[model samples]
Target: MNPITLEGPRLTFRELREDDVDALFEIYGSEVATEHLSFDPRPLDSVASVIASGIADTQVDPRTVYALAVTLKEDPGLIGYARLALEAHRAGQIGFALNPSVWGQGYGTETVRLLLQLGFDQLGLHRIWGARSPKNAASARAMSGNGMVEEARIRDHVFTHGAWRDSITHVILEDEWRQPER
Candidate 1:
């Protein structure tokens, strides 16, 4: 599949490259930035590994995951990244992160909407889902903004930052997504 370029008012999404390793490491290495992610702050040794893994995963499982870089079209700075990953039974999961400086400006919502379109329209996915810790109000809002409905709250589903946090699952089905408003 060709790389995707998703645009919004303030951000653009494009496929990541090997050259992005340094920038990715800068953002992903920070404890504050990586706080809510499934993985902990990335290790120095894993920088190359991460980039390679993303590329390899996309090639080996095009239907499973596509990792993309998020940047400002004007300045072209690598601010963050996003991923659309196919889950079991043809469902998809969306995840992303942006530089702390860009939070609250609506980039996350826009990027996610584009991924949902790609998942449902282009990839023929049956459903798309997202999950986050309850404390991450901003993430929850972003997911809801893209038409995802709260499906369930998996209590103590994950251990992070020395605590067991509930994972709130949100999903939008293909039929539900076809509504006029969406």
Candidate 2:
């Protein structure tokens, strides 16, 4: 897990680099893209620090966070951010955000699958779950399409944009996951 990399048909999840600031800012700093995420649009200057932290997370003894840069196979540029944070009992929570330019395509689903692969396939995790804002229908569909069932609603789960928002969680157990057709 020192240097994470996961590839799919159209996308690749690789370790974040310091140079990814501008690309990541395109997604993290977009109001439309982060509308339902846990935080408001981030400042450009802050994105560098985020990348730095992700790079640092990789060097930890027992890595619990995989904050990856989602790049297309054809273009080796960061277009999205994908995260899988490990928890107790062999569980992990996934989260992702893509550049608004790629919203209509199916990359979101692929990103989720790649993260699942990293957790369940590579890390031997027992369960993987993701939480999305109640209003993010696209995220709901993406997670469900990957066999992650809508499990619960956490009240006041996050306080973002100056308000308490609830989150809908979707989960899939190791036994329930079927590897994507190779």
Clashes of each: 0, 0
CA displacement after TM-score superposition, residue 25 of candidate 1 (Å): 2.0
Q: For each candidate, give its TM-score against the true structure.
A: 0.90, 0.96
User: Model 2: per-residue lDDT, tens digit, 1-182?
Assistant: 57887899999988999999999999989899989999999999888889999999998889998999999998879999999999999999999999999887999999999999999889999999999999999999999999999999999999998899999999999988964542
Segments of candidate 2 deviating more than 4 angstroms:
179-182
| Global CA lDDT computed for model 1 | 0.82
Name the weakest run of 10 consecutive residues (lDDT summed) in model 1: 55-64
The total number of steric clashes, by the backbone 3 Å criterion, in model 1 comes to 0
Q: Whole-model Cα lDDT per candidate?
A: 0.82, 0.93
Q: List the residue pairs that clash in candidate 1.
A: none
What are the per-residue Cα lDDT tens digits for candidate 1 across 71-144? 98886667888888888887888988887878888888887787887789888899899889887788889899
